[model samples]
Target: MTSADRSSDLSRAGRLRLAVAQLNPVLGDVTGNLELARRARAEAAGQGADLVLFSELFLSGYPPEDLVLKPAFVAACREALDTLAGETADGGPGVLVGLPWREGDKLHNAVALLDAGRVVGVRFKVDLPNYGEFDEKRVFQPGPLPGPLGFRGLRLGVPVCEDSWNDEVCECLAETGAEILLVPNGSPFHAGKPEVRLQVMVQRVVETDLPLVYCNQVGGQDELVFDGASFALQADRSLAFQMGEFCEEIAVSDWRRDGETWICESGPRVALPDTDSARWQACVLGFRDYVEKNRFPGVVLGLSGGIDSAVVAAMAVDALGAERVHCVMLPYRYTSDESLADAQGCVDALGLRYDIVSIAPAVEGFTECLGPLFAGTHAGVTEENLQSRARGTILMAISNKFGAMVATTGNKSEMSVGYATLYGDMNGGFNPIKDLYKTQVYRLAAWRNANRPEALKGPDGIVIPENIITKVPTAELRENQTDQDSLPEYDVLDDILECLVENEMSVGEIEARGHDRELIHRIEHLLYIAEYKRRQSAPGVKITRKNFGRDRRYPITNRFRDRS
Candidate 1:
């Protein structure tokens, strides 16, 4: 039937059963994603749903990245959508799914509405996000303001992800006779991002006086973690339903025509997790998806007994079950007995496989080889780096032998100031706490020890030793080495880095915040100088507005510093 025919049929007032599939999609896994969508549709059908709604690019997966550029990949996504459309012949429930589409010479991020074995309508995203990790402008073309899609006798306004963040798209849909707004999003989780999303949607609702269903994709896509906190906002600004965060769900919301408008009646209303719990879940989900989606057998990491490594090990255990996590203590001559005990304590607490490998032989061999070259110079950072490199090598060798991915444990504070060794401790397939500040790392460790989420795979109650959390953090490359010896204390360092990295505050602006000018300048210089190191670092979960790799991109060769 024609779209006009469908619109005319929808003129009669009735109730519509809408299913929101808050699912996790693996990027570039078109077949897997298709299967996922098919299962969700079946589930919705069984639940007596009139329509199934999926997050943005549910078939191709959200933020397919550069994979969308490949015509073959786009073609595969289109084929999958067509196959899904054909399945609608059963007339169980229509499907509204997002995918990358190509028409003529333009590639657009589009959503297709399928009903009765045919694509009723397709709407393209208008506001292609470009800043802060989004590169939609770099890829797909921005489409014109779209009208609502005709679905089952109703004008369902479909806004793909970023379009609903603004007024123009939803406004146009409302003006064009859209009764209810369904926004499919690939919104990633950052600290307090849910509130931001709600505020944006609230503004749109207030403007258009339309009840909106905000469906977000859940799961980890590399550095990005989509918190599937999907919900419906009524015209009166009341929440109709709220899906759980950091988990997959297919919730059905009932909508009934009210006088000339449609309003959400009732559905799932799961409570959103607190900020800390949400962030921790995001980290765990991101790590798990990275390892599993990439087909890694498991993960391996060096358990230094330090807060950073201990927390990472806990996250690893939580992400992949304790059996899949291998914790190795790579000790050198300067490695402390306390560190050894703490490492063992953590492993025992988490019930993961533990190993102790001495790095003395490798460190001695490296020193012996480079002894002549360094004969005239005093031992310093280079020597300390050798120890880290030795440990990193041992972890990589373990990874190679066991087919386990390495989890780098460096936090944002260390990464910002180049405190981490490039090829040494930085060697890993992924870093779960890459964007968390050292202070935040300690807080997360304590939080995890005190409370275990139902989703955690590891044993409950203080997996990280209290001593590990209380002790002064150190690399232990020297006799009494501490991180503060090379850089400022974490409390001060994180604040400065937050200003410089996240806020992009100038040196003077930072100084105005009660920090010394010299200290700010030094930190800024170090942050800029470490661009090359960060450029080579592994991708990690993004927990902040500005993360190292995707959110904040800096030139390695640039000499510009915010001296002002």
Candidate 2:
């Protein structure tokens, strides 16, 4: 008899209890990831799971990227996989785990099925995704079209992520007698991505006529954030189970075969948050993970009493507790009384530590040092920028002394245009609201004020003062200087920016949308010239399909402008 037949305790009795581990794992830490796998497998065993399914690259962590190219790293992953597979000798739950598998000379994104103290089968991913924020083909070679793996007495189709997204892989598996499809994903979150995943999975189910289980990883990795909204769908394309998003949970479900088809007997079905709620949770989760993973003691940011900083401050309090978020107000000669009051109101609501440091000393010192250099120049943008640089320097000093990360708070609208100063207010380790446009920042601020979700760490009801949102946004560098003094209004600016950055629309196309043509040209020019600033900007969580870092890569020395 084969190993599958010889294992007495391992039998397919037309019913199976499968557990899905929606977990967060740190990349490049194979030892930690292995331990995580061990704990999760043990937990699933305690819950009486027949088999446990983990997300893609659960051992080495997903998107190991260029790390897979290193022979030593690939070897470490293989060793960990073998150790994990050996643990199944306890006759506990079987594990369908993902890892980087190195064969002879080829390395692939692969998953192995383990049971009865041995690896029963191994399958490599067929389709390697190479789109936005994904470049699997760059690091690992693609495997050939695959068939089903016979586990116990049932035939199982295991399609790793992108395999199920295309019809060829699933179609091949189904034609070769696969019973059910289990998809392992390391899918990251973008606005509307959850719905996009559902539609894609539904289409695969419809095409293959097989029940599918999608298990996704949950956590923040650099600029990307994964939401573990794992679920199962029956052959009829009906929802079998729906797990919660932005939280880690090992959910178990019972599945029974109905003639030739399998259906989930029972599993969790939860109400997902709307767009605004999901976006907030994503930001909080991303920010929290970045801080904790990097081992920052806390975070510090300038609370300028503007919507952007207020929103970022509230998010910081939500991600890290109030005790860990430090807000400093750097006042100068042009500082407004209303701004000071608003900043105080925000700190009181969030209940975080607040301090006021005057930038007059730093600014005056710099002016004295540069008096000869600026003998013939007017006190225009340069003088105003000195104020911002002073604040940036002060925040950086606090960060260096207290071991807290500086949280830069610049929205996409400011970054897209050259409105923000480099090494000045743009100084930070990370920006929580970098991907959000100015209008979206206002919207999220309003959302946070009205409702505090259960997942956040901040307090509820008016964490951001209403005046902060209603008032005109400004750098407060000069007397009565507002953002509109140089650029258009935020509402108009954000709309135009979205068209240019996200939509990549031409000047004429933007003008067709009721904006002036010359304005579009000017905005387009600003967007191109600001590429260097964005290149030096801090990374943030990606909420949109095209964020500044990975999604949009433009040349810094380009001269082509779309006059069409």
Candidate 3:
């Protein structure tokens, strides 16, 4: 018989069951995350799984960043892994767990295979992704190319997260007499990443001629949200199982002898959400996890009755429930009756705790205090900034008193072009819409009104009123201070921002899109000059491929503009 037949014969039994553990691991919580692993292993055993696989760096959590530099943190992870390994001494299902492994001078992103209460094998990630939201190469030293590990009677080819992104790792395993491939991942979600990941695996299956299983983590880590849409593909490239996205789940798959290779007999298949629903789910999950993980009792935000604030309030209600969400209407002299009514309508619809706090006293106090310094200067943008500062101060005070986190509400458009006040409206613990463009804010607002997913905690149907959607967007800090007074209309502005921020197009190229040359130049200047402001903005969910913080990094002091 050939190697394929020999590989097949190594399986002690005719049947093998595999379990995918899609779990959320708290960063640097070695003890807690170890318990999570133990629980997942127990659940997999309950499902009659012979093997349980977890996502990458599950013990230390994904992208531990600078924490890996601390020797104590790395030692804690190893100690916890040893504890978990010792527990496997019971005849339960084996575990393939990912963690940071320190071998002498080199630290590796590795996964340990445990059975019969001890680690049987360990595999390290060969590929370290360094582009776009990933800085693995900066933290982890890549391991040598790997071959398959023997488990029970099967030769299992296991590649850690980024290793399977390319063809080399999978090809090496296939050539070295591996019968199957299983990949553990901490892949975060972008708009179209799920579909892209499936195609990448399809190519792997085609090249290796072996079945493959993918297990990804779920929940938010900082601004990155990992949607656990784990799946498996048979040798023929047929989907065997698909776990749901954005939730924790333990799904199992059965494999049967198909000639010299094993093929998955099939498992659960959850339909993936559409792009809009997926984006909505990502934002909610990210927002919820950030609040819960950081130990915030609840959240508070100033509800100006604009689309951005309205959308954030709804998200807050969905994420933490209406009881935890506090909406304060910080109205000034320019605050329209329509706006006040709209804000109240939102509070009533979402069942939120509502309060109307006039900023008249606070603004007047500031004006009086600064009157001497501003005696000769005309009343302009500086005074307009006072209104926002007053609102921010009030909301922050409320947060402090109630032990709630302040949730700022600023969309990508405002954030990209310095349309926000630094210590004023931009003052919050987090912003749910920080990465969402103005048009996307409008789009998701309408989408939320139309459909409420089962996953969200908030109530359904028209949570955002029609008037909020139809109203002209404004800051309401001054009389008739619509956003367009200083910027282009939202549709035009959003397109230009996307081109510059996401696409990184030049002004000439943006102008080629039929925009005026001067306008493109002006928007570019705004985008560049606003870097300092963005540096100080609150963290938010990253829905787009390139978000403001981790993905896009520009020099704040650079004078170079896109002259081309």
lDDT of 1 at 435: 93
TM-scores of all candidate predictions against the true structure: 0.98, 0.98, 0.97
**Cα RMSD of predicted structure 1:** 1.7
Clash pairs, candidate 2, are none
lDDT of 2 by residue, 200-304 (tens): 999989998999999999999888999999999999999999999999999999988888888898999987889999898899899999999899999999998
Off by over 4 Å in 2: 1-12
Candidate 1 C-alpha lDDT tens digits along 202-296: 99999999999999999998899998999999888899899988888899988888898777888997888887888889999999999999999
lDDT of each: 0.91, 0.91, 0.91
lDDT of 3 by residue, 1-564 (tens): 433343354375668888899999999899999999999888888887888999999999988998998999999999998999899777677889988899889999999988767888999899999998999888889999998988777889998888888999999999998898999999999899999999999999999999999999999988999999999999999998999999999998899976778888869999999988898889899999999999999999999888999999999988889999988998889999999999989998999998889999999999999999989999999999999988889988998899999999999999999999988999999888898999998999999999988878999888999999998888877778888899999899999999998998888888899999888889899999999999999999999999999999999998888887
After superposition, the stretches of candidate 1 with alpha carbons farther than 4 Å from their true spots are 1-13
